[model samples]
Target: MKVQNIRMTATKKLIEEAFTDLLRKKGIEKITIKNITERAKINRATFYAHYEDKYQLFDEMIKGAATELINVHTKEENIWNQKQVTCLTQAVFEYLNQVKMSCPYSYQNLFPLLRMKMLNALKTHLESLFNSNNISEIKEFNILMYSRIIYDAAEVLVVEKTNLTYTEVIEEISEIILDNNQSF
Candidate 1:
């Protein structure tokens, strides 16, 4: 059983790596199951056993990446504070930059879908932390607004090349967030 699990893990990794390679070179629409299996050096049956289709694989990839990206900045306690907020904002900027660098073609092709997914994920993450604190002073609408502000700022940081250094961008994000939000 353990060996089978290991083999499964290895097979999934190969499929994921192949899909990612194809993503880096071209859009998902151009990538087929045959392409992935061929690139992965695996049979079609193996790919089907792992994923139902290319869309499923793509979704799983995006979800895994998003979870990892969010987890990197999440605290063990999920505490809501200025520092936590800064970390969350920084995570978005850094993660987007990484994606842009590693998968420029995929990033360009999937920017809209990526943006929506990232935004919703970021909002949900922030909401969870905010809800945990149960701060009566900060309303739910405030959480939504704050998440948008942070996401929008982070998006700008990734899209534009400004003179502002990374620290400066973080500082600015923190300032805007902290200034508007004092309760958290």
Candidate 2:
């Protein structure tokens, strides 16, 4: 039997929204379960049943949002292309534009956990490119480094969107990947 089961969608959504609303107003350190429960209008028992504490609740919310964003970016059915990558990058930019503070806060809070998930997804995409180009597999260490760099770069880029156009950002990344492949 699983110990953690988020069975009730409505209650879960309420708890999550309460945290988001609270987060927008103040930082996580200031948030407590009492505040969340009161804001959510749900009892503490329901909150505890789904989550262990405030940190988990914060993690759950941030993680859920990260997964949703990643899914939105990677869910395209068509063959991968530069156009699609550009569109995905622009979408990232647009998402940041819409929720500049919230998105970065989520990224900062959840990136370490979410980074691996995103990196794995990126590695699959990069693997496809390697296959298409007849390139060899990247080493595990290199993939790990690349993944972390990408996460850091994207997070920084999201916060610094006003300084760079989406196309400019995408082109710079493409150039770096191309240069890296040529060097290897």
Local accuracy by lDDT, each model: 0.78, 0.61
Clashes of 2: 0
State the lDDT at 19 in candidate 2.
86
Candidate 2's displacement at residue 66, Å, is 3.8
For model 1 the local lDDT of residue 123 reads: 75
lDDT of 1 by residue, 1-184 (tens): 9999999999999999999998888877889999999999999999999999987887777775665678787756487666776778777887688778767776766666677777777778877776777766777677777777777778778887788876777777677666755544
Q: After aligning candidate 2 to the native by TM-score, how far in Å is the CA of 14 from where it should be?
A: 1.6
Model 1 ranges with Cα > 4 A deviation: 1-3, 76-81, 181-184
Worst 10 residues of 1 by lDDT: 175-184
Candidate 2 versus truth, CA RMSD in Å, comes to 4.6
TM-score of each: 0.79, 0.68
Candidate 2's displacement at residue 160, Å, is 4.2
Task: Give the lDDT of residue 64 in candidate 2.
Answer: 44
TM-score of 2: 0.68
Clashing pairs in 2: none
